[model samples]
Target: MRHRSSASANRLPAPRKRFGQHFLTDTRVLDSIVEALGDLSGTTVVEIGPGRGALTDRLVARAARVVAIEVDRDLVQHLRARYADRPNVEIVEADVLTTTLADLAGGPYVLAGNVPYYITTPIIFHALELPRPERAVYLVQKEVAERMAAPPGDKTYGALSVNLQAVVNVEFLRKVLPGAFNPPPAVDSAVVRITPKAEAAIEPELEERYRSFVLAAFGLRRKQLVRVIRTVASLDAERALDVVTRCGLDPMARPETLTPVEFARLVRALYAAPSSR
Candidate 1:
């Protein structure tokens, strides 16, 4: 809950490993964060974890309004004081995951964050859970950023990669060195920009079914995907294998080997299959 001030010159404070706190102190890094948010001024924007309002100041100057969500109590107080005169900036103290994005940010909006590494995946999904956003700018672990932006053949591809890519186009803005923060972190970080696809990935009904199926397939990742289906699909293993073949997937294959499209195809096949239920 320690908040670093922008004016303080001393090496702000090292990241607290327990809280997953990493204070971004490098101006060059901050500049890139601002730049990546290209032409978002006319619209509303939300920033997660605006420690000391470094990015908040830049965002407020450009956007119609800036809503910043900070969980750290002391930091929220500091932000209120810093932006006391700026009516455009609304600061909220709450956990980003539990806060409904659309309710917190009404209408369409863009999101920015230096998310705690521990909850990166959940937070990303949390943001996407709301109405489609213009784009999301995230400062996440370099490896995670890579995973998020990973192409089909990369070993980094997983349920997360498939899930995110199915709904959005992801691009990495820059790979940040550990030194960019107040206390350098053990791992490198990267700035990634994700824009939700103009077309919904699938119809709402199909999308939920796909999400459920994908989650099941990846649930027992080490086991063959058919094993997961047998447990979750209500279909017997033999029947699930038949559906897997109808969907053009190898019943023995692992979830990582399947593409997002293949997963969607499997969901369609499962729906078509006669169910014992």
Candidate 2:
């Protein structure tokens, strides 16, 4: 079905609850988001969930090409019609989670999105996968942004923090309140910029193991490092203490206090340590 232009008719499709749609309507915030993306002159941007095309309008102006992925059929049709005349903008009708950035962009690209709140973490991790985007700017829930950019020893620091920080430099740009959207979300939102590190703390080959190790550590977060290593590495108490101490981590220190580098160090140590199970 051909969707009418929201702009021409002064009507927009109702925000679908199933898709977790909250159209960002604040023009100031919109300008700030596009500005945060830096120069896109010759860049290809993969925009996730381009609801109502507010950000898309700004992105298309600066970006050489934009592949806007929308899961909602109605929004997809609307976007397709909206950008029909523009050869540079390609509206992809697919779930961002199911489609990889490499597949969509075909090469180096920047990612921008006001993603669904429920799937924000998954989307972030997806973007961080192999053949990663050059840079990514996301409008995510404020607390999730804090968790992403949280430092070691912070209350919000955990598996997500360590996992993302190990590979990328996370910057919490600004906080956005609920009123900025067409239908205000219950919680506040924030913008974050993520740039891949030239030298990641953990090697690509070790990323899966690193993620698993970090998850195990935070699963038993309240416990000491010695205990976490013992359980996750299937080592004896003495061996676990040896490995923890060898990593220069205090045997008594909790997982939440360890930095991404420390965690990567511990992962290497544990991988090298023979199991005593």
Candidate 3:
């Protein structure tokens, strides 16, 4: 029943667990999410995982153009057929993460979706990597949404936080109750607003090194970063201690203790140090 499954006197199949299909069925919550999108106007909006078109209808109405990407082939056909009459809406059958900037069409677009919780990270990474998207809004797992928007020194802050905040400013929009979904997820969901940073806080040249360094530091979170660096690189504790001093970081500081800027400073200092090689 691909591309032909329309709501009939007899409804189509319910949410499928394999697709991680937790369809958002609450109309009030749907309106709230669209409101948070805020003035779609002439802008293009891309909806990821538009299961059963609950949120898709609201989004397509708001934006000048809408592209809905769905991985499930059955859903793609159904969605294509459902919105086939609307020239403004296009249904692309592919994983959202594989989609590139050029594939998204001419200018900056806004991204919105109730994404599958399992692949949220890669999806966020994909959106952040896009050259034209002005922002992204997602209904994600509540705990993860908090971690995505978390600041330095928080327990949730780490590679994901550092990498994302480096490119986008994340804000927790609102929490969504499990009852809002057809097949309620085991955990509650929340919305997050992603606004990309025009200017990076760290030097672009050292971004990868900085991330590797930060990840290495966090690999052994219980130990001081100085100790972890010695384990990750050739630098002995004494020389690693020297690099820490040059970077103005405390010898006893753990990965959780450093800010992104401080971590960048450590990256610069460590690179410049002869012992770091």
Best by lDDT: 2
Q: Could you give the candidate ranking by TM-score, starting with the highest?
A: 2, 3, 1
lDDT of 2 by residue, 152-265 (tens): 999999999999999999999999999999899999999999999999988787888899899989999999888888899999999998888788889999999999999989
| TM-score of every prediction relative to native | 0.86, 0.94, 0.88
Estimate the overall C-alpha local distance difference test score of candidate 2: 0.90
For candidate 1, lDDT tens digit of each residue in 160-249? 788887788899889999998866789999999999877655444566677777777777777886787787788897898887887778
Index of the highest-TM-score prediction: 2
The window of 10 residues in a row where model 2 has the poorest summed lDDT is 1-10
Clashes of 1: 0
* Evaluation by TM-score, superior candidate among 2 and 3: 2
lDDT of 3 by residue, 104-151 (tens): 656778888998998888788767554747777899999999888888
User: What lDDT would each prediction earn against the true structure?
Assistant: 0.79, 0.90, 0.78
* Clashing residue pairs, backbone N/CA/C < 3 A, model 1: none
lDDT ranking, high to low: 2, 1, 3
User: Relative to the unseen true structure, what is the Cα RMSD of model 2?
Assistant: 3.4
